[model samples]
Target chain A: MPEIRVVNFSKHFGKVRAVDNVSFDVKDGEFVALLGPSGCGKTTTLLTLAGIYKPTSGEIYFDDQLMNNVPPKYRNISMVFQNYALYPHMTVFENIAFPLKAKKMSKEEIEKKVLEVTKKLMIDKLLDRKPMQISGGQQQRVALARALVKEPAVLLFDEPLSNLDAKLRMMMRAEIKKLQSDLGITSVYVTHDQAEAMTMASRIAVFSMGKLVQYGTPDEIYNEPKNMFVAAFIGNPPMNFMENFKVQSKDGELFATRGDIMVKLPPKAKEVKFEKTEGLVLGFRPEHCKIAKKEVENSIPANVYVLEPLGRDLIVNLKVKGVGGESELIKIFAEPGMNFEIEEKVYIIPDPEKLHLFDPETEETIL
Target chain B: MAELRLNFFQRNSSKISQAVMIIILVLITSPILLGYAWLILRSFSVDMVHGFIPTKLTLKNWRFLWQEMKGYPNIWRTFLNTFWIALWVMILEALITSMGGYALSRYDFPGRTSMLRFILVLHAFPSISLMVAIYYVLKVIGLLDNLWGIILLKASLEIPWGTWVMKGFYDGIPWELEWAGLVDGYGRFEVWRKIVIPLVKPGIAVTAIFAFLSGWSEFVFINTFIFSQNAWTLSKYVKGIIGDFRFADYGLLTAVGLFYVIPTIVFFFFVNKYMIKLTIGGVKG
Candidate 1:
C-alpha cells in the first residue's frame, strides 16, 4: 500500500482558486476525511489526489513517487463517486469485473475474482441485475464492489453516501468504515457532513474558503479547534459566540466582559497570550454550559426565548441581558423533562475549561 | 383546478375526445397510407392503367425484373450497386461520426465552440447547393462517376449532421462513467470504446439506418455524375423507365418502386426490435 502525501497543492480555474495551497499526508491504512461546507475546496483536493484534476502547482507523492504527470489510470487509485457512477449497461457481475477485464486477465480468473468480491459483499444474488434494477443501497454496494475488485494501492470517495436516505446513509457509513479498516487501504473521503467525519475518520482535515484550516484527530479538531470557523463548523448546533466583548485586565489577571456582568477565565489562560484588548470574542460550546434556576457565580442572567426538546436533552435559546440593555442570544443544552418554559428567567454558568476566545478581526482562536 | 378538470371531462365524454383524435390522425396520415395502397395495387396491374383503377392483374412485370439478369436488361446489377454503396456509406459514416462527435463533446480546445457552430452552419447549406463545385472537385481528382466516390461523398456530407446527433447522445452520458473507466486502468480511447460507444447504441442505430436510407435513395448526385450504363444505380434506372415523351411503363415502375421501399422498411424493423430493448439500461437513473 502506498501512503499518499500532498504538499503545497493548489488548483486554479481561471480566476477562482478552487483549491488553495494545502498540504496533508495520509498514512497507509488510515481513513482521513476532508470535511468542509459547500464550495470549501474539499472536493477539489480529492479530485486532484485522484488525478481527475491535475494540480496547478506543488507536488503529490504516492509512497514518495512524484505523481504530477501520472494519469488517473496509472495512479493506481480507485474512486467511488457520490452518485455511485455504475455502468448502467452492464450487470453487477460485469461492472465489478470491468477493471479486471481491463487488465486482460484470464476469463476464468476474472469470473472467479468477481464472484469472490460479490460473495464477500453479500451481493452475489444481484450478479445478473442491471444497476437500475437494484435498490439504491444495493447500487452503492455494487459500486464498492467495483472499486474493491481492482485492489488498488489507494482509495478515494467523494461523498459516496450522500445520495442515500438518512437510514441507508447511516448503514452505509458504518459498512464503509468497517470495510476500509478491514482492507487497510489508505483512503481520502471528501464530505460536508460533520457527523460523518466525526464518526468515520481517523483524522479530519477541515477546509474553508479553499484553504485547509485545521488538520487533526477528531478529538483534537472538536476539543482544540484552531479557529472560530473550525469550532463553529464542527459542532451540531455550533459553538455560541459572545462577540464584541471588552477585554479587561485587573489584579494581574485577564477577564472578558460586557461591562456590567463579569466573566471567568480558564486556569490556563495565563499560558495563552493575546494583547489586543479593544475587540475580542468569547465562545463556549452549548453542551458545556448549563442553565441554573437560582442566580449562580460567574453567570449571565437570561430569559428563555424557546425550548426545543431533542429526545434526551432540550436546547434552550436564551436572550442574555447585556450591558446598556443589549441582548446576546445563547443556546444552552439542558436535560429534557425539566418543565422549562419560554420567558423563564435563568442563569447560564459556562465551564471555564470549555470556553474559547477569538480576535474579532482575525476570528482565529486565542486559546 | 382539479374539480374544474373533473367537471369538464365529465361534461365532455372521453369517447368524443378519442374520436376527434382518431379523425385528426387519420386525416394527417391518409395521404401516405393511400399512396402505399395504390402502389401495391399498381404493382399487380399488367398494363398502364390510369385514373386510379386496376384494369388487369399480372406478375409479368415482377418476373421481368427478377428473371432478366442477363445483358443490358438486368435490374439486379443496379440494385446491387446501390446496395453496396449504401452499406459502405453507413459503415464509414457511423465510424467517423462516432469518434468525431465524442471528441467534440468531451474535449475543450481552441476554437472548439466555433468548430461546432461551423459544422451546424455548413450543414445549413444543402449539398445540392454545392453540386457544381463538388462535381468539379471530383473531376479534378478523377473519381467522378465511381461508386467509391459516391460513397465517400455521401459519408462526408452526412458527417456534420451525424456528428451533432451523436454528440447529443454523448452529451446525455455522464462523464463519471468515463472517469470510472479511467480509475479502472483503461486508457482514454479504451474508455471511449468500452464505456461510451456501448452506451450510445441507440444513437448509432438511428444514424446507421438514416445514412443507409439516404445513400439508398440518392438520385440527384448519381444522376448528375454517372453517364455510362456501367455506373448506373437503382434510382437512375427507375426514372429511366419513364421515357422522354413521359410515356412510361407504370406497372413496371410501380413494381420497382415497391422493391426499392422494402429494404428500408425491413431494416427499420430490424433496428427497432433491438433499439427498444438495448436503450432500456443504456443511461443511468
Candidate 2:
C-alpha cells in the first residue's frame, strides 16, 4: 500500500471552484473519509484523487510520485460507487472478474480470484445472478467483491451505502470498515452521513463550500471542532448556537452575556485572548445542556416548548428570549422519564467545561 | 337510497370505460382490417363483385411467383435487390448513428451544440424537397440507377433520427458505469464496446427496425433514381406494373402489393415488443 498525499489541490469547472486549495494526506493502510453536504467539494476531491478529474492546480502524490497527469486506468485505484454500478447485463461472477480480465489474467487465475473474493464477501451463491436479479445489498457486496478482487493500491468509496435501506446501510458500514482494516488497503471514503463517517473513518476531513474546514479523528472532530461549520456538521440534532453574546469581565472573571441570559466562563476558556468581546456566539451540543426545575449557577430561564420522546431519551425544546427581543428555540436531551408541560418555565444550563465560543464574523472557534 | 343510484355509475365506471375502449378500437381499425381482407381476397380470386363477392377462385394472379412477366424482371430478382438494400441500410444506419450518437452524448468539444442543432435542422427538412439536389449528386457520382446509391441515400436520410434516438438511450445510462470501467483499467474505447454498447441494445434494435422498414418501403428515391429493370426493387417493380392505370391487372397488382407487404408485417411481428417498449421509454424519458 502507498501513502496518498495531496498538496494544495484545487479543481475548477469553468468558473465554479468545486474544490479549493484543499490539502490532506492518507497514511498507508489508513481509512479516511471526505465528509460534507452536497456540492461541498468532498466528492470532487475524491474524484480528483481517483484521477477522474485533473487538478486545476497543485499536485497529488502517491508516496512522492506525482499523479497530477495520470489517467484513472493507470492510477491503480478502485472505486465502489453509491449505486454499486454493477453491470446489469453481467452476472455477479463476470462483474467481479471484469478488472481481472482487463489485466489480461488467465482464465483459471481469474476464476480462482473471483471465487475467493466472492466467498469472502459471502456472495459465492449469487455468482450466476445478474445485478437486476439480486437485492440491493447483494449488489453492494458484488461491487465490493469487484473492487477487492484486484487488490488495488487505493480503494475509494463514493457514498456506497446511500442507496441501501437504513438497516442495511448500518450493516454495510460495519462490514466495509472491518473489510478495509482486514485488507489494510489505503482507502478514501466520501460520504455526507455524519454517523457513517464517525463510525468508519480513522480520521475525517470535513469540507464546506469547497474548502477543507477541519481534518481530525472522529472524537477530535466531535469534541473539539476547529470551527462553527465542523461543530454544527459533525453532531446529530446538531450543535445549537446562541448568537451575538457580549463578553464582559466582572471582578476579573469573564461571562458571556446577552439580554437577561448570562453564562460564566470555565477556567479553561480564561487562557484564550479575545480580540473582539462583542458579537461572540455561544455554542453547545444538545446533550451537554442540562434542564433544571429551579435556577442553578449561570442558568438561563426558559419556557418548555415541546418534548420529543426518543426511546431512552427525551429531547426538550426550550424557548428563550434573545438579545434581539425574539424567541429562540434550543433543544437539550433529557431522560425519557422527565416530563414538562408546554409553556412551563424552567432553567437550562450549558456545561461550562464543554461550552464553545465562536467569533460570529469568522465563524471560527475561540474556545 | 338516492345516493345509491348516483354511486351506481361510479361503481361500474371501469367496466363502462372498458366497453367504450373496445368499441372505439374496433371502429378505428375496421377500415384497415377490411382493406387487408380485400387485398388477400383479390390476390387469390379471378374476379369480384361489389368489392366483396368473388366470382371464381384461381391461382392465376400469383403466377408471377414462378413465371416471368413481360417487361419485368423475375420476382426473386426484385425481392433480393430490395432485401439487400434494406439490410445494408439497416446495418449502416445502426453502425454510423450509434457511434455518432455516443460521441455527441459523451464528449464535449467545440461545435458539439452546433452539430446537434444542425442534425435537428437536417431532419426537419423534407427529403422530397431535396430530391432535385440528390438526383444531381447521384448523377455526378455515376451511381444513378444503382441499388447501392439508393441504399446510401436512404441510410443517410434516416441517420438524424437514429442518432437522436440513440443519444437519448445513451443519456439514460449512468456515467458511473463508465467511470467504474475506467477505474477498472480499461481504455475508453474498450469500455464503450464492452459496457456501453451492450446496454443500448434496445436503442440499436429500434434504429435498425426503422432503417430497414424505411429502406424496404422507399418509393420516390428508387423510382426516380433506379431506371434499369435489373436493379428494380419491389416498390419500383410494383409501380411499373401499374403504368398509366389502363389495362392494369388488378389481381396481379393486389398479389404483388400483398407480397411486398408480407415481409414488413412479418418483421413487425418479430420485433413488436421492442417497438412498444421504445414508445413507452421515449415518452417517459
Candidate 3:
C-alpha cells in the first residue's frame, strides 16, 4: 500500500472546468470518498486519479512517484463504474481474467487469481455466465471481483452501488467497507449519496460545483461542517436554514432575532470570535428541535401544518407565522405516539448546543 | 372473449379497410411475382407456344453452367474473378470502415463534426459523376482494366455509407466499458481490438454484405475502365448476352442472371438476422 497525494489538481474540458484546483491526500489503506451532487466534479477527480483524464494543472503522486504523464495501464489502478461496465461479450471468468491477461500472465496464474477473487466476492458460481445473464447485484459483485483480481495499487469506485436497489445497496455498502479494511488497499470512492459517504468513508472530501469545499472525517463533516453547503448537503432531512436574522447579545447570552422569532445561541458560542453580527442565518436540524405545547424561552411560536408518521418517529410540519412577512415551514421529529392536530399552535424549542450561525454573505459557518 | 367491444360502424369500417388493404397489396405485388415466374420459366424452357407460356423444356439454355458461351471466356474463370473482386472488396470495406467508424465515434479533434458532415456530403455526390476522374486516377496508377482496380474503386465508393452506419453502431456502446478496459490495464488500441470490435460485429456484417453485393454486381466501372474481356464479371457477362437486342438469346441471359443472383439470395438468408438487428438498432439509436 502507498499514500496517494493529489496536489492542486485541475481538469478542464475545453472551456469548461470539470474539476477546479483541488488538493487532498489519502494515507496508506485509507478509504476516502469524494462526495457531491451531480456535476460536482467528484467523478472527474476519480477518473483523473485513474489516469483516464489528464490533469490540466498540478501533480498526483503515488508514494513519491509522479503520475502525471502515466497512461492508464501504467498507473496500476482499477475502477468499478456505476454501470458495472462488465464486458457484455465476456463471461464472468473472462472478465475477471482480463486484467491478468493484459499483463501476459501465464494461463494458470490468471485462472487461479480469478477464481480466488470471484469466490471471495461470492460470485464464483457465476463465472461461466455472461454479464446480462446475471441480476444487477450479481453483475455488481462480478465487477468488484474483476477490479480486485488485478490487485492494483489503488482502487477507484464511481458509485458502484448507485444501480442497486436500496436494500441491496445497503448490503453491498457493508461488504465493500469490510473488503477495503481486510485488503487495506488505498481507495477513492465517488458518490453523490451523502449517507453512503457518511457511513462508509474513513474521511470525506466534499465537493460543490468544481471545487473541493471541505475535507474532514465523517464525524467532523456531520457535526461541524465548514460551510453552509456542507451542512445542507450532508443531512437527509437537510439542515433548516432561516435567513434575515440579527445576532445580538442580551444579558451576556448571544441570541439571533428575526421579526417576532428569537433563538438562543449555544453556550459554546461564547468562545467563537464573531466577524460580523448584523446579517446572520440560523440553522438547525429537524431532529434537534422539540415541539412544545406552550411558549418557552428561546422558542418560536408556530401552528401545526401536517404530521407524517415513520414507524418510530413522527415528522411534525409546523408553520411559523410572520417570520419574514410570510409563513415559514418548519419540521421537528417527535415521538410517533404524540398527539398533534393541524392548526394547533405550538412552540419549537431547539437544542442550544446544536444551533448553528452563518454569515449571510459568505455562507460560511460562524459558530 | 368479450363480445361487447365495438359499435356497428366501427366493426364494419375495420372489415372494409382490411378488404381494401388486401386488394391494394395484391394489385401492387402481382406484377413482380409474375415477372419472377417468367424469368425462372424462361431460364428452363427452349420454346414458347403461347405468349408468356413455356411449350418445350430443355437444359441447353443453361449450357454456360457446363461450357463457356461462344465468343466469351470460360464461365468459371469469370465467376472466380467476380468472387475474388467481391471477397476483396468485402474485406477492404469492412476493415477500413470499422476502423474509420471507431475513430469518428471515439476521438475528439478539430473539425471532427465538420469531417463527419463532409463524409455525408461526399456520399451524396453520385459515384457516376466521378467516373471520369476515377478513370484518370486508375490510368495514372496503371491499374486500368484490372480486377484490383475495380475492387478498390467499388470499396472506396461504398465506404462513406458503410462508415456512417458503423459509426452509429459504435456510438451506441457505453463509454464506461472502454474506460473500464483502460483502467483494467489495456492500452487504447488493445482495448479497441479486444473489447470494442467484438461489440460491433453486426455493424461489420451489415457493411460486408453491402460491399460484397456491390462488387459482385459491378458492371459500369468494369465496362468503362476494364477493356480486357478476361476481366468481365457476371454483370458484364449478362450485359454481353443482351448486347445485340435483335438476335439476343433471352434464355441464356435469364439463366446467367439467375445464376448471378442465387449467391446473393443465399448470402442474405445466412445473415438475415443481422439485417433485422441493424434496422432495430437504427430505430432505437
**What range of 10 consecutive residues in model 2 chain B has the weakest lDDT sum?**
B276-285
Off by over 4 Å in 3: A322-324, B1-26, B282-285
Docking class of 2: medium
For each candidate, what is chain B's TM-score?
A: 0.89, 0.94, 0.91
Pairs with backbone N, CA or C atoms under 3 Å apart (clashes), candidate 2:
none
- In candidate 1, residue B62 scores what lDDT? 84
CA lDDT scores, all candidates in order: 0.87, 0.92, 0.90
DockQ of each: 0.69, 0.66, 0.69
* Ranking, TM-score, top scorer first: 2, 3, 1
Task: List candidate 2 stretches off by more than 4 Å.
Answer: A335-337, B1-12, B282-285
Residue pairs clashing, model 3: none
| lDDT tens digits, residue span B72-122, model 3 | 777888899999999999999999999999999999978999989999998
TM-score of 1: 0.93
Q: At residue A62, give the lDDT of candidate 3.
A: 93
